[model samples]
Target: MDVAEYTPQELARLQLGFIIREQPQQNADHSGTHASSRKRELQRGQQKARQEMLDDLGVEA
Candidate 1:
């Protein structure tokens, strides 16, 4: 899947637990799942939602 087609929320949602630990290959570094651990959990939920949406479209996360 094209990463550029993903929404900001979808992209941000993917970088949950390993924020600074995971570096973007080509894009600029993004500060996602920051602030607190709960934020990461929330992002996980968002990721789940996005995944479900993709699944409905016959795409797997």
Candidate 2:
């Protein structure tokens, strides 16, 4: 689906799904430190995207 056609709630849901999907696995061991850090960063970005979507909807976060 086109992002421009999504409602704020739909965008937020999509972002949340991304966050969930990208979450670091507890048993992840390859690239140990760097992978964990990168995962953390990506999760933070997903959270920010979700917040932005909520803000666009004028939701009091």
> How many clashes show up per model?
0, 0
Candidate 2, residue 51: how far the Cα is off, in Å: 0.7
Task: Name the regions of candidate 1 deviating beyond 4 angstroms.
Answer: 1-35
**TM-score for each of the candidates:** 0.39, 0.58
* Worst-scoring 10-residue span by lDDT in model 1: 20-29
**Residue-level lDDT tens digits of model 2 in 1-61:** 7889997767777766766675555425565777678777777877787787788889988
Over the full model, what C-alpha lDDT does candidate 1 score relative to the true structure?
A: 0.60
Top model number, lDDT: 2
Give the runs in model 2 whose Cα sits over 4 Å from its true position. 1-16, 19-31
Candidate 1 per-residue lDDT, tens place, 1-61, comes to 9999988766765664355344343124544454445455556676677777798789856
TM-score of 1: 0.39
The per-residue C-alpha lDDT of model 1 at residue 56 equals: 71
lDDT of each: 0.60, 0.72
